[model samples]
Target: MYLTIPVLVLLVDLSFEKEYLSWKLLTTKVVFGQAVQLRCHLPKQNCCHNYTRSWRGGPDYTLLTLNEKSSNYTKYIEYLDTESRTSVLTIKSFSESEVDIIYQCSYGFSSYEAILQLTRHRYEFHPTESVPVSLSFNGTHMYAKISLEKVFPKPQCYGNTNEKDITKESLKVISKRNGIFYKSMIDFNYMIDPQHCFGLVTITCTVGTSRITIAEQNTSCRKNGSTFHGKHLAQRDSVASNSHDEESNIVGKVLIVLCFHFFNGL
Candidate 1:
């Protein structure tokens, strides 16, 4: 039953400078109610013939050998092939309590370690909090902007306008929390009908099993409204500063002329 459900398995190769050993860590991305597998193996090398392999994990660093198969919430399996040996650790269900567990596969004196970092893949926007989205029309194009908070492992965001995919520019790590969660921003623009700059705008972002979407009919384009929200708002202050600079220069010139006349009088 556990193998029947859809799961995403990601293989990450951890390369080392030592030619005597070749190993990799495989991570399976899973949701809260799902199971996850952490696999460690020596690939394409018969490096395990001389060294004994074992696994250690959990808060107490409990050592697991070939005979130990089940722990509190974990299951361990080790098998051998013609060219390699593999050790797999499976968590029955993933949750907050199962996080921060360090799993390691030890081969003689060398070992590879991986920690369980829980990632929330299917997050829902709370009703009290508003999704940060803004829309504006600049005569020829309509621009939509959104900011997503607390996304981990980065994300791929796609923007669509009227059922067609548009290009999205992203800014990563505008903010971070707890050294893991990050804030991401995306800007999307599309050429609109000159007569009607309104259309359906949608943005969807995915990270692991987590996906977020925002779709709406862009009705913010109206005549005589602010066409650009992020444009310069201090033009008047800039002109005033320039005028003050000119007046200060004229005063300095007059003071210099007065000092010259005073020294001549003396």
Candidate 2:
């Protein structure tokens, strides 16, 4: 009877650990300008228990959605306590602003959290040349492509100034001056433009080590004699060069140490 009791307790503990450690969200990178579903899965044994899920924006804990007090919140936000143990947060339309927020999933006794961010392509236009430039990343390097409406009198162009790590590969200029508009794409190191002052300049920036990506597009035009000359800029979305693997490793190690101390106390 004593041996059987120990075995039963061991099995129960293992079952809890398996369910507590299950993967909640499956996707690593969420694209900008799309809706996302955040899910939480409890272990089979715990799936029948009541759980609460909530989300907060940034480290400031600005509450975005909560499972409590439905009448106090907007209609777009809904709570589904479908089963006792599992809960899900459905974001109808996910935007770049929401990417940096932290999502927390909790039960009566345990909780888990993750950071959200966005990824996508970007573009920028230089008005002096009346050309549109786009940027993209190829895992290890960055590049750019330039498209033009009319052949400029000059052959060289300059990209908007950005931080150092976000440097672009050699600029590849595509001149289709004969066409009404030209299109091109290129690779470049990740960069964050801090001087984004206008509303229409399309710029995409992702937070470091977080799953947040912000994309903005802007345009400005001036009347030149009888014609209107303008520039259109779109920032492409790129993963922040910064990664959370190191932080995750540190967190995992700390959890292991806490578990050891907990068992020792027991």
Candidate 3:
């Protein structure tokens, strides 16, 4: 279920050709939970000052920075190829939320971008124990969010009923990349089953191309003071148990406002 996004290529004119970098392809694509390889060919330069190697994504955020001759990368592996005059980036396994992003390589004065898109497989999309995804209620409405590097194409959420039909809803993508790497946030309004009496609620979260996570937790809606709890999800045996009646959408709409106050005493 991997989906590819079209990439935009930008050109720059250099009077001196020493700072040019070339890409093997316009875009680099990989399936979710898989590895990928990227090559950034470098041009010979006569400058005395050394050029730095770094990876850029989402505005000016730098995902990784290192000397081309470094021994090893912490998360992924990289190597400087002297034979082909190229810099390589290799991801052994991609489990991060931010996979759909524009990744660029910078070596001193030369920089170029290669679109990176990761898609889920047809069957599985849930974040494993290593990566956690949550869908919980914040009193008034249910919000779903995941901690990822980026949410490309953005994720769409939906609700399911006993009849097996699902309805799609809008999902919002939020990012917290200050000037370095991004810790993206994606939230959305959770739709509920109209027949909340006995029918189950299957909450499925999907990014642009494929699924992310799907769960069927027994949650009850509140008419007045109901609370929605979405602890971190587990791939298997994901059960949030409560014997109380399930709350309806009407009852969970009670509104309340508060202020931030520093407590003088415990």
Scored by lDDT, the top model is 1
Query: In candidate 1, residue 49 scores what lDDT?
Result: 60
Across residues 19-66, which tens digit of lDDT does each residue of candidate 1 receive? 233333344445544555566665335464666666677556687554
- Which lDDT values do the candidates have, in the order given? 0.54, 0.42, 0.51
TM-score of candidate 1 on Cα atoms, chains taken together: 0.41
Count of clashing pairs, candidate 2: 33
Per-residue lDDT for 113 in model 3?
Answer: 78
Q: For candidate 3, lDDT tens digit of each residue in 48-154?
A: 22667765553334565465433336445556777666777775555444455677777776778766544332212333334334456554445554555544333
State candidate 2's TM-score: 0.34
Top candidate by TM-score: 1
Instruction: Please state the error at residue 162 of candidate 3 in Å.
Output: 4.6
Checking candidate 1 for backbone clashes, the offending pairs are 121-210
For TM-score, candidate 1 versus 2, the one ahead is 1
Worst 10-residue lDDT window for candidate 2 reads: 229-238
